[model samples]
Target chain A: MSAADAIAVAGVTKVFGSGNGQVAAVDDITVSIRKNEFFTLLGPSGCGKTTLLRLIAGFEFPTSGAIWLDGADVSDTPPFRRPINTVFQNYALFPHMTVEENIGFGLKMLNRPKAEIAERVAAMLKLVRMEALAGRRTNQISGGQQQRVALARALAPAPKVLLLDEPLSALDYKLRKEMQIELKRLQAETGITFIFVTHDQEEALTMSDRIAVMAAGRILQVGSPREVYDAPADRFVAGFIGESNLLPGTVERVSGGLASVTLSVGGRIEAVAPDGFSGGGPATVVLRPEHARLMPAAGAPEGAIAGTLATAVYFGTDTHYHVRLADGSDFTVREQNRPSVEARFHAGDAVAAVVEPRAARLLRERP
Target chain B: MARPFDVRRQRGFTVVAAFCFALLYLPIVVLVTYAFNAGESIANWEGVSLRWFVAAAGNAQVIDASIRSLQIATAAALIATTAATLAALATTRTAPYRGQAATFAALNLPLMVPEIVTAVALLIVFARIKMATGYTGLGYLIAAHTAFCIPFAYLPIRARLDGMDLNLERAAADLYATPVRAFRHVTLPLLWPGILAGFMLAFVISLDDVVITEFVKSGGQETLPTYMLGQLRRVITPEMNAISTAFLALSIVVVTVFFLVSRKRD
Candidate 1:
């Protein structure tokens, strides 16, 4: 690892209960995060992403393995002594304290001088644009303001790593989007590592430098948003990262990096296999919705699968056509709504679905 | 807070509520008003005077008893409230423990049992201790009071503890505070009002207790209530009524203050 590696977890495991009741909440997992990176854990609820974050934060102890922060083993350290902070899901502002006081509590715990605490709190409040509401009781503020206060309080302490557990999940749509950009800007300004947890894939893709996509208490893939979206490693990741049509199939032929597979439904398709898939075997092909082209029967080309448009959804920027192919496979294609005749597609019309061979991914079928 | 004139139903409710209030307050009101009676008779109406108040003030035994009661009740409330706070914290904050309900029921056993039973059980235990070490300390009364008052203090505090948001403490820990620091800074401040109310309730309960105090107290260790009870056996005096009236007023004041404090928090 380089000097820029801020947090490293190796073979971490967490089990709840004992003996007959034992259930593993987090299976053995390993990850490394670089300094000043806004990394996100993207998974559905109950996927152990939050558990992994808590283990890193020292809020929950790992049942096995080690966690390192800034090259020091901090697995056994308590939360307070660790150079990490978190913004809780509910924003957890101290109801008894004013906004200024709530933001100043961590500094107070450091036993900083009163004047210094005041100065730092003032700067933090101004950064969050909450200086005007600093004197108000925390419960008296609006949810968005409280959210800012929670962020300000966490950031004011100058932690090396900040964990945000679904911080924007409680906010309304507009505020959540606004906070996402604000958080990105704040991370840019402070140059601190942020490990945010969320189930929203779009939010993760939009705000994070890298993302660890998790499911069933295990990490499925870790990569940049574009990398994960365009080149998912497995069916779970492909199905998760973006909308995709997965066609389970058996591998019939394999070349250097490409594979021609016979789908389960009696259709031959080509896919780009991940490295190290050697030969003939049962496999699955994944295709992104936008990768497939929908053309009317008159303009259709050879090698195109025939289908009828089941539904056409108009989404301002793009129109998605859901086509049910001859093999009974439902495929969706998103066409940009440019001012052209080709942009118009209607449900119940016969069309041809064409996807370039390289646009699809092939994965070995799981038991 | 006003009801725009409901003729019949409102009057009926008003009369019924007024009757209940009268039933609650009549004795105490009469006692306070006539505590200044100039005559010595207990049953006759007489002009008021400050004689009994003066007498009550000058009596060394009554003053000593009052001081002792205050000390014991304060100690008991402090001890009980502190223990109850810890119990509340463990049950609310930590990961759920097995048989938590059983633990809660056991802690709350004292409230369900009769006060006489607790008084006798304490007396027997104290007797054994005294026989073993020959110490007739008043510490036993404080201990008994603390044990009996635990349930009264625990219930309200535990309710507040349950209602308190755990997210605040998580936020504190996330902000790099140790668990103890989070409890001190975040949990305690949010829980203070409930703690105060619980303490005050335990204090009042300990002070007004007569049966338990009579059973556990040794000869010559007279609390104010016990002293008044002793007087009641021989002759009923308006002077006893005056002391009772004072105790009643104190209870009302503490309860009212508790309500105001909790309301202001809301």
Candidate 2:
């Protein structure tokens, strides 16, 4: 591990139960989280993201492999001995304690002087904008206030790393959005390495400096938000990150760092193939909805695929057109709502979907 | 709003409730009243006086039995509550394992089985131990009472642990509290009411227990209830009534304090 690495999980595997009933909650996984970076583990429920966070928090021990924190092996270290803290999904604020007491608990456990603990708790409560509620018990506060208290309590000790497990999942949409910005601001201010776990793709994209997209006990790909969203590693990652139009095709020709694929829908399209492509092999062309443009069939570009607009969904900011091609495959193309009336397309309208070669990716088909 | 039931039906319900209360408490009221009887006979109360109460208080055997009962109850309650708390934490906090159902059943066996059977079984075990070691004292009573009260203490504690959010304990650990410290600060504080309730229940149960105390006690280690039973077998007197009234008063105070402590807070 590098000096810059805050947490390094190497070949960690956590299995629950035993014998025939044993199931691997976190399969063998390795990832190094850098210091002072907002890293996220993103996946759907049962995808082992939370389990990975728990393993790092030392609430769980791996079946095998080591967890390194700040270049020290802490695989067998108890949670209290580790220089890490967690903001639980439900906040889990101590109902019996005042917010100030909750935030100061760690410092007290560490045997800090009473004066220093009081000062630190005051600073933490101020950081989370929970100064007014500091004297109140957790149950007396609102959910959002309790969330702030949980964050304050976890961050008060200024641990080397902070782990958040879907901490915003309980909030309403508006509050979640507000806290997202607040959390990012806090991370920037604190400069503590954050390892956030969540299933929400938007949350991961909005907050993470780097993301590891996991599914079924394995990390599919580790990259920045834009990298995973634009160039996913596989069909699963492609479908998971965001909306995409995956057109099944056969590679017709490979030239100039790009591959021309003969669409199953009786058309030809070009896509940038990072890996050298072989002619006549089955491939999937990942076309993001926003990358495709809807045009009139009569004056459409020569390489554009033709289809009938099956449905038009108005989403205020953009209009999503579900188009059915000649070969029965469907693709959704999102068009921004223009001021002009002619830019809109009705259902059953003849349309051609145009995708730029550089905006599309050609990936090998997985069996 | 129109009435859903007739006034007669409502009055009939009230009458039934009053009858049940009378059946439950009238005998106790009479006993308490007779404790203050000025006369020697319990049945013939000449006037209300504190003579019997004073006599019962001054009686050396009564005082000794009461002190012995208090000692046994306190010791048993402490032992039972401690064991119950540990058992509760084990059952509720840990991941489920094989034999968990069996463990639960075993913990509750004392409550489910007839008291006479447990009393007899304990007597046999204690007798065997006495025959081997030739040691007999209030230790056997304390042991028997603790065993019987374990379920009483375990139930409330387990319920509290079950209702608790496990995440709070996890959060405490995450905040750098060792397992012991986490229990001290978070789990124990949240479970305080339940623990207090369990202790009080066990104390009351141990204090009033007759069959178990009777079977388990050595010759000179008669607890208050066992001594009262012995007196009743010989003859009924206003002194017995006075002692019973005092026991009842003590129980009521404990139960009332328990309810106050365990009442829900905002």
TM-score, chain A, per candidate? 0.94, 0.97
lDDT of candidate model 2 versus the reference? 0.90
True contacts kept of each: 0.80, 0.87
Which residue pairs does candidate 1 place in steric collision?
Answer: B36-B49
TM-score of every model?
0.91, 0.94
Docking quality (DockQ) for each candidate: 0.63, 0.75
Show pairs that collide, candidate 2: none
What TM-score would you give candidate 1 relative to the actual structure? Answer: 0.91
Q: Judge candidate 1 at residue A201 and give its lDDT.
A: 94
Worst 10 residues of 2 chain B by lDDT: B257-266
In terms of lDDT, the best-performing candidate is: 2
Off by over 4 Å in 1: A250-252, A262-268, A327-329, A338-346, A364-367, B1-19, B36-44, B47-51, B58-61, B257-266
Residue A340, candidate 2: Cα error in Å is 7.7
